[model samples]
Target: MPQRPLARALTALVAVLTAAVGAVAVPGAAQAAAAVNYVALGDSYSSGVGAGPYDLSTCLRSEKSYAPLWAAANRVTSFKFPACGGAVTSDVIDSQVSALSIGTTLVTITIGGNDAGFADVITSCRFGSTSSCTDAVNEAKAFATGELPGRLDRTYAAIRDRAPNARLIVLGYPRLFETGSCGLLAMSTYKRTILNEAADLLASVTAGRAAAAGATFADTRPYFAGHGVCAAAPWIRDVSGVIEAYHPNADGYRYGYLPALTAVTG
Candidate 1:
C-alpha cells in the first residue's frame, strides 16, 4: 500500500477501536448520553399551580415547575407536560399516559393528593369551624390510608406500561404547615399537627407504591421542613387570592423539588 494512504487508514482504524473500547468500558454509555425524552404527569404540584406563570389556563403548566427546571438544566430532547391543576390518578391514566412512550427516558409524577381530597380539606379547614376542620382532616386521612395506595399503584402501573424503558420518579407532597401559629389565623396548633401527619402519610403511601412499581420516590417533606406555610421563609403560600395558595412557589420549585429530582436522576 502507498505510505500516505496506509497511514491515514491506520489512524481511522485506531479511532474506531478507541470508540468501541469506550463504549465497552462504560456499559450503556451511549444510551445514557442520548438526549432524554421527558414527560411530566400528575396534579397541581407537577402543573405548578402555586409556582406559576402558567402555560395554559386549564393545565396551569409553569416553566418554573421543578420538572421543566430540571429538563431545561439537563439534556432533554423532547418534553410533553400534561399535568393539570386538579388531576387525580384516573385523570393521569386517561389523559397524561398518552404522552409517554418507549422512547421516553424519564417521567416524573406528583399525583394522589387530589385523589385523597387534600384541597377540600384545606378549604374546609381554612374557612369552616374547628369541628369541620377535624372532620375534613379525618376524611383525608381515611382516603390516604385506605384508597390512595390502590390509586397510586394503578397510576404507576399505567406509566410503566406506557414507558417501560423510562425511569419514573414519583414525587410526594410536603407538609403544608409548621408547628407554631406564625400568624396563620386559619387553623389551630392541633389542626396543624393533624394536617402535617396526613401529608406524611400521603408521602409514605406514595413511596410504597413507587417502590412496588420499580420507580424512584422523592420525599419532599424534609425539603420544606422550615419552609412550610407558617415558616419564617415560607415556600408554600398561606392563603393567596390567586391559585398559588398551599402549593409550592417559584422558590420552592427551584430550591426544594429541583434538588430532589437532580439528586435522583443524576
Candidate 2:
C-alpha cells in the first residue's frame, strides 16, 4: 500500500474504535445523569422502625424503608441513610448531619416527633387513664408549638449549612388512628383523636419551620387516612410489638410514604 493510503486506513480504524467506545459509554453516562447524591436523615419513621429486616441493628434501618425504596427507585448516585430508630432533632445534628456535604444533591428528613416526647405521651396514654392521655396530648401540643419549632429550625439550618445546594424534603408524621373503636391494645377513640390532633399540630409546626428553612414539607396524613392502627388493614403498628410502636409498617412505607414522597419530588 502507498504511505498515504496506509495512514488513512489507520485513521479510519481509530475512528471506528473511538465510536465503539463512545457508544459503550452512553448508557453509563445517562445512568449517572439520572442519579444524584442523596442523604437520608431523621427518626424512626425515616429509619423504618416497625418495618423489619433491618440493614443495621443499631440504627434499625430497614431495607423496605421508604428512604431506601425511594433512593433505589430514583437511582441515586450515592445514598447515605443515616436515619436511626429513635432519632430526635439533636440526634440528627450530632449523628446524621455528618453524612451530608456540599456535594449532596438531595436530602429527606423526618424528625421532631421524638423532640415533642411523642413516644412517652403515647406510652403514658396507653397505660394511664383517659385524663392522663388528655394531659399527655396537651403537653405534647404545647411542646410542638413552643419548643419543637426551634429544634426543627436548628436541624434544618444545620442541614442547609452542610448541604446548601441540596433539595431538602421534610416528611411529617401521619395520624396514628382513625376515629373509631381501636383494638384492645389501642387507645380509646377519643384519645386517638386527640393524639391525631397532636400529630396534626406537629406537622403544621414542622411544615412551617421547613418552609422557613427553604425546604419542602411532605404531609403524610392523607396518605395514611384509613391505614392507621385501628383500620381494617392497619399500616401503623397497633401495639409496641417492635422497637417503636405506632410507626409505619412495610406496607405503609411502600404504599403510603413512598407515594407521598413521589408526589412531592415529582
Candidate 3:
C-alpha cells in the first residue's frame, strides 16, 4: 500500500510550501506586536527632579522616574527622555518636541507649572506674610486661568504635529502640601489650601486643553492624595534646601505617577 513516486513528490512539495508561508507570516505578526517607541518630554516632574541619582544631570533625567521605569518595565523598542528640570510650555514647543517623530508611539509630558510662576509663588508663600502669600497665589491663579491655556494649546498641538502617530499623555502636578501641622514647616494652613487650589485649577485647565488637543490627561492628585508633602508617608519633598523641594520623591514617581500613567495607558 505504498504511495506512488509522483504522489509522494507532490505531497513533499506541499509541506515545503506550508513551512515557507508560516516562516513569512510569523515574523510579520511579531513585528506588528513589537513594543512601542516612547518619548518622554516636559519639565521637572517629568524629568524626576525630586528623585535622585540622576542619569542625565544636565536635565535631571532620573533612572527612577516614571518614564524610565515604565520603559524598562514594558520593554519598549526605544525611549527618548528629553525632559528637563524647568521646562515651561514654551520650552516644550521650542526644544522638547524635537525628540518626537512619526515613529514615536507614546509620549508623556508634565508642563505649565513653570509658566504659571509656581516656583516663585511657592517661594513667596514660604517666606512672605499671609497677605503676600495670598496675593501670589491669586496672581498665579489668574495667569493659569488666563494666558496659560493658550500656551498649553500650542504645546500640545506642536507635539501632535511632530508625533502624529503617538498616544500623547499630559500628566498633571500633584497638590504639594497637606493642610495640617508639619512640626517645623512654616507654611500656614491657609497657604496650603490656596496652593492645593492652584494645583487643582492647573489640572483642570490642562485637562481641558489636553482634551481639545485629542490627548489623554492623567491627573496625579488622586494618586498622591494622602501622600502630600506634610503627610506621614509623604511622596512629595517638603521644602528641601535643594531644587528638589516641593516635588515628587522617588516613591512618588514609582507609586503615584507611575500608577496614574499605567491606568491611562491600559
Worst 10 residues of 1 by lDDT: 181-190
* TM, every model: 0.88, 0.86, 0.88
Candidate 3 Cα errors over 4 Å, as ranges: 1-32
- Report the CA-based lDDT of candidate 1 relative to the real structure: 0.88
Residue-by-residue lDDT tens digits, candidate 3, 12-91: 99999999999999989998687699999999999999998887368888988999999998889999999999888898
Q: Choose the strongest candidate by lDDT.
A: 3
- Each candidate: what lDDT? 0.88, 0.90, 0.92
**Candidate 1 on 148-195: residue-level lDDT in tens?**
889888889999999999999999888999888666365778778888
Rank by lDDT (best first): 3, 2, 1
| Model 3 pairs in collision | none
Residue clash pairs of candidate 1: none
Q: What clash count goes with each model?
A: 0, 0, 0
What is the C-alpha local distance difference test score of candidate 3?
A: 0.92
Q: Give the TM-score of candidate 1.
A: 0.88
